[model samples]
Target: MEVTTNTQVNERELWGGGAKPFSASYGKIMMWFFIVSDALTFTGFLVSYGFSRFKNINSWPIADEVFTHFPFLHGIDAPMYYVALMTFILIFSSVTMVLAVDAGHHMNKSKVTFYMLLTIIGGAIFVGSQAWEWKNFIKGEYGALETKGGQILQFVNLENDKRISIQDFAIGINSERKTHKSNIGLWYQNEKTLPKITVEEVKKGFLANPNLTIRTEQISENGQKTLLSRDEAIYKIDDATGVVEGANLIHNEYGNRLFADFFFFITGFHGFHVFSGVVINIIIFFNVILGTYEKRGHYEMVEKVGLYWHFVDLVWVFVFTFFYLV
Candidate 1:
């Protein structure tokens, strides 16, 4: 009589046993399935994003102006630097995850724990930095004027090519005692309103300042922005110092509503993923502390999470290319 032993039962048979529960290597299989599904989800999002980007053919905010913020420099014209740093942080975390898995192979608990800690730290820093980036983006810079056709027009100092802001043209006015004040008792107390400055004020300032020139947001790849000569710029406006009406999102001072929407959705989604990735890393970090994988004799958990970390990095590469470099 032939008897079946555990070793004799092939992996396929074990997993596909008649009316049997799946007996495959749980970690690796789950990791692969998760990755496949996640890939499809990301693909859907990116494709939809692409469709919107393509549909909005004429006017898009230049990614450079939209994301230009640098650390310690306050409000300098540094675009893509912070995100580049975040990208490196995620990539570095992936390396640490791999190192953690390698250490787990030799049952070196200390090394595994150390690398895992570093990985968690990297993920956290990336999320925080991303938050700052998003904050700056939503607030906007050099607040634009949107035309009826949905084009953005921006201000620039012609002599130096430095962009101008509404703040530069702002002449602070003294508020009356009857002026509306923010509610203090609300859960989110009153925030100070941004002082209003008119487009006319800006144009008048520009006229006075000969170095100033106006550039429309419709720029080509060659760095040529459709610009307005001083006469043309001042000519279009009935009131140079009066504020251009409407929010910057719909008919931005730059021109396209789609640009702001895409900026919010695409980068917002990517930032959300980064936030969730950090949360997952934190959970894995605690698992490492508890020696959960050590008991299993495999650090496949770390490897699985590592794959996710790398995937985030990979997505960012495409985003950077399309949004900035391209």
Candidate 2:
């Protein structure tokens, strides 16, 4: 009995290497890899923002005062309300996406289609709302004076404690104030469009109105902007070198220019993600409608897109916490 024992095994008895690792397909694994890389990118951006904010802690703008506008509620002073609503919309969309994925798992094409449509609608509303917010931020509400050192000085009525717009108090001055056109100025040094009012006009107006006072960008321990006395307000107005009407890459009437820069970049990046997720969802939605996944006997595509949608919603929660709530 020449017994080679179990050492002489047949080739067919050896383990085959055709199975997927962790039972996940290549497409699903690729999506996860992309998400992890993108998350690291967002983390870098947020860390930079946090450091900048801490360095400029005194002059940073208050989120409540900056984002007070709401759709159809002009002059309501509803701080952070609209942002909260936008967050809700995005989270709700994530829920619908979950339903869609679950329906796909069960091979229920009709339910998947219905849930995907709901998710698309929710995303559209959120994107549109974000556009409106950007418009308001750029257009600005109450204008402010920018000091020589780039500090923002807002105006408020001492009697009513309400904000006062430059348009209401600035006295029109007849002078040689002209908009700098590209033809007249240096070819490479084109000026941004001039503000509706001038610094001198604002100064003159401030001197004339005893009831109006200046609010510095510095927040007090009481969580309010530092208000100056009548005399201090008038004295500060003399240092106003320019009038800032709205937010831009160069200037932000709200407060520090860096605040606006971070706001635009971080929020814009997240918005782009949401938009991309919406497009992906729509494509998957159509495929489901056409019985493509039904013929394949699985709805893993819907599950993958669902993961992306959920990630987008999760990122917004972090953004809302750092930018708005905190």
Candidate 3:
């Protein structure tokens, strides 16, 4: 019967052992597997971050206020400008990768080489920019006081209702303080470097200056930090436990400690991926120059790396959305 014979042929074609599913090679299939797994991992992290932020919505740091620094534009308030530039650069690099893959398909070694180099350069710039941003974040701008209850107290000027740096108001009480090391301490505790200004000094300066008011981490109904009256500020400052100059695993001058934790983990993880991609791209760049793919009669390696680069770029879009915009 013709019908039975056609059914057998169809089964053979469908179940063939040598078949490439969806016309994809083994390498592409593996890359897709990796990308899918990685995407799930990123999703879990972002979900956790979302939940934590929701739980601490009142104390969460405002992304715009926190990430306002731009290189060579110190003391200027330019929110999200540098981050937008970084996103554009990364997306543009993805475009270059697409062109590189297309050139590889056509066996155009020169074009592939040019585009790969450009992608590498773009990736390098993004990584460098992220590092610079990290430096500024860790260094901090306006210092805050941490209470015994783990609350942050920032200072603002009543005249302009703007934040003022600790140096602007805090009176310098320079005293030599030694860092606690395991070898030097009886409790075997190791401590980080001391903050430039101490809590005692900030408290002293607060009492001396009448214009500076305390801004609590609690967000009011207007979605702004709660500004305490002069009487309340003086009452609140008495509960000061330490001076937090910047963010770390335990303390964050910005706001909630969890915000800094999620920020470092997410962005640092993404930065690692970008750095790895650049290194891989550089290797492929040399191969393109040396005609290794030409000898093999295929540039599948370039296409494979292009897939990875595209995945990295796509993940960053989600990261930028969650971390910056939201």
Candidate 4:
């Protein structure tokens, strides 16, 4: 009877005996532990993000302004739309992964395969969308000016608060400027090169051309350097633009070098993570097509990669919040 009781207890425990049952395998448990550790690591990243926010409390950029582009809604000021779409795509992939796991439990290889494929396709789409977003970010919509002091000053076309670029400010009939020759010493021929229009000249033309004006020094500097304030705007000639001067960092408009350094470092790190996630997803996707996991009777590999994908998404959430939104 004791032996019978022991056997029954073991069977029950192995199947569904208690809350603290030790029936799960070492591999699955380790995966859960690893996920926990990874969660902590992400938390660390977010905490650091918070620290930076605190440090730059006054100068942080607005996420909404920075990421206002939609997939097709050109000229519309809809912010967070694409990011929301990407978030949904990731969540949907997670659902498909869970469905794949269910199919695996039922021993339905075909259904599991289909769901896995869908998950991969969704991930590919998300990565593609991310690439698009990155392209826009790198190209920048409204370029800013960098100061000699490494500070960014953005120009607003006085009539509109929307940011303007050096190209935008260019006005009528200035003779095309000659490029500075690198080997001026070797080529002594005073080739009658057309005189280049000075930034000062460009500024004067811009002032004369009612379409442009100087952005107030007090108007810009909220991290983004994208927005301009017409209220504080001055009609006075800018020393730099003479035509119209505003401060900004794009095109080294801000003289501050640290702005460029920080911009590249932070964005580059995030972009690298996105690139790595794409490569990893591609590997898992091919594995799904090859039916490798079906033979193994489990698609836990998908689950692992899914965790990583979710992590990248989560990090972007914070980055968007801090860098763009906040």
Q: Which candidate has the highest lDDT of all?
A: 3
Model 3: clashing residue pairs?
A: none
**Per-residue lDDT of 43-143 in model 4, one digit per residue for the tens?**
66556656765665555444565577887799898888887787788668767867866776776777777886777677678768767866666556654
Residue 291, candidate 4: how far off, in angstroms?
4.1
Answer with 1 or 3, whichever has the higher lDDT: 3
Cα lDDT tens digits, model 1, 1-326, are: 24455445543334443433454355567776887887787677677767766676545556676677887897677888877887788789878978987887788888988998898788788878877876666666666554545455677777777777756754444444232445544454454343365454555565666666667765566756767788877664432323433233444343466655665676677778777877887888788789897776567677778777777777777777777765
Task: Give candidate 3's error at residue 151 in angstroms.
Answer: 1.5
Instruction: Give me candidate 1's TM-score against the actual structure.
Output: 0.77
Off by over 4 Å in 2: 1-17, 184-189
RMSD to the true structure for each prediction, in A, is 5.2, 5.6, 5.0, 7.3
In order, how many clashes per candidate? 16, 0, 0, 26
**Could you arrange the candidates by TM-score from highest to lowest?**
2, 3, 1, 4
lDDT of 3 by residue, 1-326 (tens): 99999876655444247575887777878898999999999999999999999998888888999999888986899999999999999999999999999999999999999999999999999999999888878878888999999989999999999998887888878677767788987787898777777888898999999998999988999988899999999999999999888788889989898888898999999999999999999999999999999987789999999999999999899999999999
lDDT of 2 at 142: 92
